[model samples]
Target: MDCEKQTTEYKSLLKIRTGDKGFKDLSVTCVALANAQGGRIFIGYDDKKKAPLPEQHVTPDEVNEAVTKLRSLCFNVGLVASEICTDDTGSQYFIVSVSPSMHSVATTSDGRIYIRVADKCEPVRSEDLQRLGEEKGAYQWELVRTKYLLDGVALDALRQLANDIRKSSRVRQHVKQMDDVELAENYHLVDEGYLTNLGVLWLGTAKQRSSICYPATVQYIVYDVLERKVRKEEWHDNRLNPKELLLDIEQKAVELTYSYEFPNGLFRKQIRHYHPKLVRELLVNALAHKSYTISSDIMIKVFSDRLEISNPGGLPLGITKDNILHAKHRRNPNMIELLSALEMMEGEGSGYDLIYELNAMEAKNPPMIESSYNEVTVIQNAEIIDTELLPLLDFVLQNYQLTQKAFTAFGIIAREKKVFSTRLSAILQLQEEDRLRSYTDKLLKDNIIGRNGAKKGTQFFVNPQLIKNAKVNLKTTLKTVEPYVLRTLIMEDLRAHPKSKISEIGGRLPEIDLQELRKMIYSMVDVELITEGARTDRRYALK
Candidate 1:
């Protein structure tokens, strides 16, 4: 077969070389790609296919010898190599198919290991190797032997976690009569007469935890909307246990979020004003699956509009961001189990799915998952649902059975004034009075909407508090104002008088309509520019 035809068959998997000697490097490259994801390497053609092909024949004996050497080098590390076919052309080419190993393979002799990243064979860094080892259940910390007992395993945090477990029926039934050691063993904290990395992370003293690779350390940062770097912090250093550390980090996340209050006649109800659950879930997931063998800590970054949680390690094997919701793999199963025992998670594999579902239900952006060489990050965007739309959604949800078509209709009605005929029919099918009332009840339960009046005379609108608390006007309420006109008026007045009264500002620009001026004033108010005074006189000042 022609080189071009072979290249087309293995576009992503194959890399071509011009000469016969390049086969030696190609062997290792094949191994690295296979170790990551099975791929093939082709020898005898240039990568760009511009160079002339070599006119040499590689004998079956030489091919066997090379394969033998490659296999021998990776034997101790548990990687296998296979020779699939050899071309009969005078310009010889061979195919080597490397399959995903049952175990993570490294250099057997331990000098230096390499993996193909984009198009180069880069040396696998020590941190990355350690992470791979941990992901493959071969973390060295799991084999460390404790020479001394420290303060009865620091049961304060453990006891609190146990109390939480007792409250969970799923965990309580499985934990009956199980002592701390038994529980630890069941959770894989200790393995075959040795304490694992997880044991040190959860129950070991600060000093003990430090002895392990990177046990339960976390970094927290808060940023303004522009990510100007407001606060930089680290947690779980040498003074706190996993439980205390996690709780502390969670509280910090809550503290860093933006909140607003809705006033109801005589009382004010406060809402977090940010998607707290999504943030918490992402952080918790990061901690649970982090590679403890890596020396870095989990990182939480809070920005004005979003929060990001990154852990030191890539996605676990068989778990990619594409299939994260459906894949059920955990790099740190023991840590996951313990958190589940403490009721922090539903179970080992359900957190990601729940986060996605909850975000969908709240009509917020789905959490974004990303993996780099040494880290996995989950980003959560904070979006506050429109206050007025909440009541309408509640009415629809309670009174009607939900379907994709009905959901689309409700979204249009809440956001746009008109719904398509088909969509309206779907929504009408779900719009029973009792169901609408139930939906309203749910909205009230979630504090997203409020209702007033009785029976047929009752009217529903967006909750007043939601309307007032949101930073931007709802889509339905946003009125377009001419920016050039507003800027010209403001600048011209500032240039003429240095400062101006609200009435004077309005009078100076008579072409600016009253409604447009009101909208501009409110926009300016949001950014703290123009100040409204007690009397009719309001002043615009630089602040």
Candidate 2:
């Protein structure tokens, strides 16, 4: 029986017999599926033909044996669901479903761990295994008990926290009624008479916290026009507490604004460079998720165009750069709990959703979270959102529930007025046209955008009706072709040729100045839109 040629979904297998090879193969596939979104593995069916194979039927006894062997091989794997079905021709088949694991990485008998990438199982590297261990909270430093006793906890910090909790609308009535010790205990900040690391970090005196949790402090820096640090500050003392630390950071943060007066002089509009709520949310997350075990301090760097906050530890277990918006895990659960109770943060795992929503509404680029083995850095761009299309963007976000990729794609179109499929694909970091087409299709289907030209020449633009409904003058809003529009033209040329020399590309786009073409090509290469070839070749291609 032929297996499915493509690795899109379900795995196909022949009849499972009484053999080690079959069991081993089944075990490996199970690990792969479990590491990813769970999928079905069919025994005694041909996935390529989408039919039951008469010769591939497995007996009831063999199915039971297979399940036993698979479970034994993948003992560490969480849930393995199985079922048997009979076709019209009385051909029986077994279907094993492997559910994704939340904590442990699944391993086969030989001790090799695997994760599903595309349609194949790839071995999990040592680095990835370490990261997986982190995601699972296998080493939660914040949960560890410290030598410091509860008596060392600051009374003033406790009183301030309780007061804030009482005033917060998010806190429950019972929580508001609880005393400091009761509240701390409820959140697992105390173990016996000793305060956990969380308690020390939250309530210890400035000198006590600095001595005990030295690395848990934050370092703030502001860079000048030349990128040299012009100012620096530290928050090692515990006198401020976490709540006051947030307040202090806000006070130190620079808030700049741009204003425009209406033609009639009746009103004015002002836009702030950064949002205070966003700053607070970022600071809270850093404090709540940093690895207290690490010796490095959390750092917040402010530049002219962006705000970057880096925590000592990487993303919490179960969260990846790609899945952070949809995934939630707590590296410092106790800290998160107390902060949430005090209404310092939104504990519903919707923090990123709101960040993205605010970015969309403002027409600003969404904040980017990058992770390494030792740290997670978040960069929030300060570019003002384009005011012309703000209404259209806000309308779409309010009315439609779109995927992150789709939302980003919409933003690109809104900002550029029109964008080529290739440029859009490049900007979205999507390698496949088919995958990008799915998102573009949604925009087209909803009539939020319209496609101009076709195939490689395809340009996505906001639907005129959408702009009209948004109450913008169509004539004033009409997109004018810019010099950067030539970038799309060049991308289209590369799509057909794959690789081309400057002269050849120049011949294709003769309207563009030779020097301008060179500048655009070099700029594209710098941004990784195009790859440079050898000196002899001196060619460019889409990457």
Candidate 3:
């Protein structure tokens, strides 16, 4: 074989070491490759060289001995080695390709196991080992029986669970005829035909399971960077199924992370304060991949600077931080499948991609994913977002006629906050402008705001459709104004003239409110509703 050519092709998948003495301690490399996806090992070349030229010497006997030793070291696993070969110029090389075993392989004598992740080889933890064993059918936690289950435990929940499982295609086709006892036996929920800890946890009463094993619970805390303390928190136990739990938790997470408002004069229609699809996907991945074996629950930490989602589990076997975008390995396979079936999870594997795209579209840095021993975290920095806020604010500004209740339904405000007039008042103040005709006209001309209804019945909202089409150019400087007074002035102008010129409009307004009026007029100018001259005689007109 062309060793140099092969090495280039498989560089990312395998590690190559060559020109050393006969294969010494290749067992660790073998184990590491096995724990990960299988990869090839090439010998008889000087790999340490910047350009690894092939070595010119090799012994067939030594190669055979090395292969034998490696095979003997890894029980329940096998590897193949090729005979020593020479290139056209008498350069020597030997190739060994390790394949993934049906069974998880470990050192036969010492029982030590290692896995390669990125460039480092690390010991596989017991929990990971257990997961491997379960995947290989060597052992299952569901099979282990706990003596703590009480005899009189409620069977109602168990019956309901059985019904639900029976309805599923996998269980229906494979386990419909099997009764509760028989089904329990097949899943290894029974020990000598008796119910075990797995049965108690899966089918026992809520209170009973609480006594037997802690119910899967999740706690979320949001910290305010300014306050340096938790601003909000929520905790939930095993009330809903895993899929429902994920949805519920994610919704609550969005609530903690975002503040909503519908701004006017910026967009053609109303828009949400944040991208719902991106937020939902991130949280779903967190809940799906999190390690329940680790005692800590998934956490969503929101600060003024960033939003972080920390899941309990790190990368699963065969997955690393580098290849995470391409690799597919589900630590919670059942949960993943169930959520997928429920249509909560996207089919295209676009969760991470969506997060990245949203960040890019908003001109924010891409979200970051990090893995630790006990947790995997995804952090999305919202501090620098531009496009995200522009569309929503534009929508609110254009559709200033809509009531707070209607705006809230359009997703410009939180549902709970909508009920509070204080919050609504805050939203209005944040979105207000002094020049009604100019602001609305400019928003409509720019296609950032669109009109709904007709005449007095006409209302404005952020144009959801227009957001996708609008080129975002967010202003950096924060302009200060008394927004409530400006909003009142705009409403008064609209109620009075219904249509008016800038100078005519300016003549009717109070001098003390001129700053706010001028600011609103400038905003209208930016949106292109009116034309301006070099002097105060600048006029406004509908585009």
lDDT of 3: 0.53
Pairwise lDDT winner, candidates 1 and 2? 2
Candidate maximizing lDDT:
2
C-alpha TM-score for every candidate: 0.58, 0.59, 0.49
lDDT of 2: 0.70
Better of 1 and 2 by TM-score: 2
Give the per-residue lDDT digits (tens) of candidate 2, residues 1-543.
Answer: 434321224434543554677677778878876665455676666656766767555566766777777888884665444567877778777677666676776788788888765467778876566445655557555556777677634566666666777898887898879988787777676677676767776777666676764446778898977889988988765576677788787777653222333222365545566665667788888988877666787899988888899998666544656567657777767778778877888787767766765665567887887765468899999885566665577678888887765776788788766677877776555566777786677888889888865666577888878877777643443243454677888888898987789889988776554655776788898464666667768888888
All-Cα superposition RMSD per candidate: 16.7, 12.0, 18.7
- How many steric clashes between backbone atoms does each model show? 6, 2, 26
Q: Write the per-residue lDDT of candidate 1 for residues 4-102, one digit (tens) a residue.
A: 321121221222223334434555565555445344555434456522255544456655655565565453333333443334344555555555443
Question: On residues 1-543, what C-alpha lDDT tens digit does candidate 3 reach at each position?
Answer: 343321121221112233222222466667766655555676655544412254456567766766777677676556787777676667666777876554555553468877655545567887677655644446544445666442454245445555665776554465767776665565554566455655655555555445543345666666665747665655554555454566677666654446434444664433333467777787778766765555676777767667788877556655545456445665655455545544667544656645544443343555677764457788776644444554544444465564322333233221111112222233233222332343245545655445543443344544545445444443322122244655556556745664455557767763423443665766765353456454555665433
Q: Candidates sorted by TM-score, descending order?
A: 2, 1, 3
Indicate the TM-score of model 2.
0.59
Q: Write down the lDDT of every candidate, Cα atoms only.
A: 0.56, 0.70, 0.53
- Looking at model 3, which ten-residue stretch has the lowest summed lDDT? 5-14
Q: Is candidate 2 or candidate 3 better by TM-score?
A: 2
